[model samples]
Target: MKGAALDTPHIAFVGAGNMASSIIGGLIASGHSATCITAADPFPASLERLRKSAPVAVYNDNAEAARSADIVILAVKPQIMAEATDSIAAVVRSNNAVVISIAAGVTIASMQARLGPEAAIVRCMPNTPALLQHGASGLFGNDNCSAQQRDFAQRVLSAVGITCWVDSEQELDAITALSGSGPAYFFLFIEAMIDAGQALGLNADIATKLALQTSLGASQMALQSDVDLAELRRRVTSPGGTTECAVQSFEQSGLRKIVATAMHAAADRAAEMAREMG
Candidate 1:
């Protein structure tokens, strides 16, 4: 990417939380100008941490930060998203900035109502892993968003990790279930594995180290291999071996069904949140 194209746009972050800071770091690493980035947060400590890594301006007023920005990222929590967006809605629209929101369950319709119909908006779900620059995000843009606006949104989120776009706003709920809340499921499974290892007489530290390394190695292998995940798993499970016995136990216990039920519950709750937030 040309440095001029990346650095020319002025970006504003409405919240300076960890995820927001991660994005700022990424944009800078991507050759964006730190002077062109501004972040707003109520807490001085958050701003302090943000400035420790980037030389961006910090503001206590959301409107001030967003007024001249070419792109405005809404990184505030869902509970306070309305208040945050309402504070800068007029300025953001006046600036003709592309508003990219990472707050989950806050619908585009809800934002449009506050920011006016002409506001270009993108709604995205990015997980906490963004802080480590390993996040995955799902984005859905309103009709008012131009192709340029969509590209800008993609560039911003892709700074942290991978990004996928969904056809409809409703599909974002499914994405929220699959990738947005998926990390917690993996962590839970890792915890169970560690406990099982400990029960089998491995020390806690050793078990945790082994589980973490195995998770990392398996993920890297999957990413680097051409084979499908099921094939990869099958390759490790010899017939009538210990791995096969464990796989059989998991299958008999309806693990797939349980996982599906949990994911569906997450999607349902995401939909519920949209209604409640609306």
Candidate 2:
């Protein structure tokens, strides 16, 4: 192939915050050339911090960074997503760049309104754990996107963590319910565990550390185990034992129903946000 490296799609980041930094760090670590990336941020301090972390070109003007790029990543907060995308719309349309957005609550239609109807956009939902390179991302591309564009979008997100593609944009809301808001659910459980541990006589510090570590260990165990989660739980809860007692209490208390209700609320809210934004 002629100029294989030269053909690598140039990518521009519309915001240089924590998520952007994590994705950039992962891309560089995975051998994607830093030279092919550019980032724009209003704050000079944020730009400087990004530069310190990754040696990519930084710009104060979104258009300047995005101009003629093959891909543009929207990494700003949802509240500012429209303004950030508007600033780069002309540049993106001129180059026919594939737009990959990582912001929650912004839909493909809203983006197309800003970037023009023919704009190729891939909407994504990624959780906070992405900062630690242990995140899950769900992506959905609009009709304007080519197969290659979708693949490229997946590759960019896969740099940070695991990614799965959904058939419809609406399913992104389910993703929001699960992987998107899933971390907070786990954290809440840990908090409850910590408080209960303290009530049971462990010191505050000891309770906190033990709860956090146990959460981590359990997650790792589930991830590494070949058996299904229900089977794993059965193994942990021996017949007529303390674990069984706790498990029985949880089931009797309708814990599963509580979790189902919470996830449904999250999905509904996600859909509501998309509608409001749309």
The number of the candidate with the highest TM-score is 1
**Residues 243-278 of candidate 1: C-alpha lDDT, one tens digit per residue:** 999999999999999999999999999999999999
After superposition, which runs of candidate 1 have C-alpha atoms over 4 Å from their true positions? 1-7
In order of appearance, the predictions have TM-scores of: 0.96, 0.95
Structure candidate 2, residue pairs in collision: none
Clashing pairs in 1: none
Candidate 2: which stretches are off by over 4 Å?
1-7
Per-residue CA lDDT of model 2 for 85-204, tens digit only, reads 899998877888899998888988888989999899999999889898888999999999887788788888888899999999899999999999999999999999999998999999
Model 1, residue 221: distance off in Å is 0.7
Model 1 Cα displacement at 171 (Å)? 1.0
Evaluate model 1: give its lDDT.
Answer: 0.91
For model 1, how many clashes? 0
